[model samples]
Target: MNVTIVGGGVAGTLTANYLATRLRDEVRRKEIEITLISDRDKLLYEPGLLYLIFNRLEEKDILRDLKILLDPGVKFVFKRADKIDLENREIRLGDEKLSYDYLVIATGSRIVPEEIPGLTKTGHWFYNLDGAVRLRDEIAKFKGGKIVVSVMGVPHKCPVAPIEVTFLLHDFLKIHGIRKSSEIIYTYPINRVFLMESVSELVQNLFTEKGIETRTFFNPIEVDAEKREVLTLEGERERFDLLISIPPHKGSKVIIDSGISDDGWVPTDRYTLKVKGHDNAFAIGDTTDLPVSKAGSVAHFQAEVVAENISAEIKGLPPTARYFGKAMCFIETSFNEATYIWFDYETQPKFVKPNKFTHWMKIAYNRMFWLTARGVL
Candidate 1:
């Protein structure tokens, strides 16, 4: 049997590595073949981008070669998948076609700053490597002024990132002796500061203590770069010297072009992690339209379920694993302190008090993330 996985992010990489361990016997017998397809040759630790923007971590510290991370039993294919023919169980790669008995779609999301007019030209973000590098330069040159951190859309990867960046910016400016001259403003689309009420309350209190201003129900429709203003759907014009935005995000174009999902997100079974209507195919990570944070932890937890189920089927065992919307994240309140939260489908988030210990843990995880990609953690 041939198994094909598309995408090289945390979900795809971990799933490939986990399957290698589970199906080692079958692989040695030459009865099962595992192939992972990715467009890029390097796998990036995305959470490190937050530190990258702050110059706390360098580019080389957050990237690893894809071939080195994958298990030897898994074949790595460097190619961009053009379309997935679900009916024929084939993946189209430019002029070539690859067939698979079982398919895993781990295609992740992408940031679309162009979706908001003028944002591409004037705004800054840290969602991708290039954006992080550019933002780092901008942050370095900034002296003092009104800085705005806006959440333009929801379901973006790393839900707490906006809050974390706001806190870090405040600390950064304070360390640079510009806190007294700078004003920090945070904006969110909903009436509350965050989707989780508990988290919102905690963050709101922290923002208040840090003297950071917040605007609720603020949905940015367009950015007037010339006027240095952000026009909102609520008819508010917010001024800023520097605009750091969490731009709108969308799933892979390949998923959309293949008619898998209208908006690129694949319809997935939240429990089994299977693509809806296709038993032989599965979806995980940011590619799924699940009501959960599009964070790495979510992808890591889901990867286990996908790998286990697929391996079980090949080994003639019942696949009983199920994902329960498990996710965990570390929110940095300052350079030396952080807080942590974990929640599932039936649980509400309760963040721990910010402390130095948790901050160290977050730092330690940054280096250990490579082990995670190799499924050694």
Candidate 2:
């Protein structure tokens, strides 16, 4: 049996490692083959990008070669998947096709700054390596002005990142002796600062304490780069000397091109982690249409379920694993303090007060994330 996995992000990498370990005997006997396809050669520690913008972590600390991270039992292919032909159970890469007995789609999400008018030119973001490096330079040169941190759309990866960056920016400005002159305006599309009521309440109180300004029900329709203004759907024009935006996000284009989903997100069974209507195929991480946070932790949790179920089926056992929408995120409240929240589908999110201990724990995880990706933690 040939098990093929697409993408090389957290979900793909962890699932591959878990399956390799679980099916080691099959792999050694050449009864089963595992392959992972990725366009990039390096595995980026995505969560560290937030710290990268603040110059807290360098590029070297967050990137690892894919060869070192993958298990010896799994084969790695460095190529861009052009299309996923679900009908034929094959993935098309340029001129070649790779067939699979079972497939896992973990293609992940991408930021579409071009989706918003003038956003690519007028705004800065920290969602990717290039954006983070550019934003790091922008933040370093900032002397203090009105900075707008706006959430342009929902269902974006790392739902708490905008808030985290706002908190971190406040401390960054203060440390630079410019907090008094700078104004931090945070905007979200909904009436609340966050989707979760509990998290919103906690974040609102924190924002008030820190003197950060917030604008709710704010959705940007266009950015006037020449005028340095954000035109919103609500008919309000918000001016900013520096614009920091969380642009819109979408799932892999290969999935969309394959007619799997209109928006690139694969229709997936929330519990079984299977691609809807296909028992032999599964979807995880940011590529799935599940309502969980598109954070790496969610991908990590889902990988366990996918790996187990696939391994059981290959072993001719009953595949009974299910995912319960478990997700966790660490919210950095300041340069030295942070808090975290964890929840499953049935539970409401609850967070403790930010403290130095939790802050260090987050820092430790940032460095230890490689182990998690390798399924070692």
Candidate 3:
């Protein structure tokens, strides 16, 4: 049987590794073959990019060769997955085809900043590596002014990121002796700062303690580059010297174009992780429209469930494994202090208090990610 996975990102790579390790004999004996397809040769550790702006990590340190994920029985194809002919059980690479007995769509999500008028032209962000580097330069040059860190849309990956960025900026500016002169504002469409009630309360207190202003229900409609202001749907205007935006995001082009996704994200059974209406197919990570935060930890949890289900099927057993819709995220408060949150569909996020050791755990995660890809940790 040929089990093909699309994408080499966190979702795809981890799923491949878990399955390979789980079905060692099946893969080794050629009873099942695992093939992973990637559009890029390198995997960017996105969570580490935030630290890049503060000089905690270098560019090379945040990226890893995708080739390192491949073991003896696993194969990788470096090509753009243009489409999937689900009816024919084949994936189309331009005009070529790769047949598959089981498929995992882990193409992930993408940011579409240009969707908002002048967003790309006026605002800056640290969501990507290049953006982090560019923003670092701009931030270092900023002596004093209003800095706005905002969420342009809902359901973005890691809802706490903008909050994290603001806290880090406060510390960074204080270190440079510009904290008093600078105004830090955080805005989002929702009234709360985070999904978890307790976590939201914690973040609200943190915002107040750090002297960062919070603005809610500011549903952004457009960004005015020349005017240095954001116009909201409610006719309110917020101005800033530098705008750090969490732009609009959607699923990948292939997932959208393949017609598997409704509005760029495919729907899946929350517990089973199976793509709705497709018994032999599943979608994981940011590519699936699940009622959970789209973070790497969520992807990691989803991958384990998907791999387990596939392994069960190969062994002529039913899929007993289930996903609980729970995920954990570490919020970087400053250079050496951090906190974490854990939430699921049933429970409110009740996190541990912020401390130094939790911060180090986050730092260690940057390296542990590689071990996971290499199938050792």
Per-residue alpha-carbon lDDT of candidate 2 for residues 1-377, written as tens digits (9 for 90 to 100): 89999999999999999999999999999999999999998999999999999899999999999999999999999999999988789999999999999999999999999998999988999999999999999999999999999999998999999999999999999999999999999999999999999999999999999999999999999999999999999999999989999999999999989999889999999999889988789999999999899999999999999999999999989999899999999999998999999999999998888999999999999988989978899
Question: lDDT scores for all predictions?
Answer: 0.96, 0.95, 0.87
Whichever of 1 and 3 has more TM-score, that candidate is 1
lDDT of 1 by residue, 4-119 (tens): 99999999999999999999999989999999999998999999999999999999999999999999999999999999999999999999999999999999999999999999
How many pairs collide in each candidate, listed in order? 0, 0, 0
What are the per-residue Cα lDDT tens digits for candidate 3 across 1-377? 98999988888989998989888999878899999999988988888878888787889888988887666667889999999877788999987999999999999888888888988898998888778899888887999999999899977866778888989999999999999999998988877876566877888998999899988888888999999999898788999999999988888899778888666788899999888988899999998899898898898889999999999999999889999988988998887799988878887777778899999998898878788776666
- Which candidate number maximizes lDDT? 1
RMSD of 1: 0.6
Q: Name the lDDT of candidate 2.
A: 0.95
After TM-score superposition, the amount by which residue 182's alpha carbon in candidate 3 deviates from its true location, in angstroms, is 0.2
lDDT of 1: 0.96
Whichever of 2 and 3 has more TM-score, that candidate is: 2
lDDT of 3: 0.87
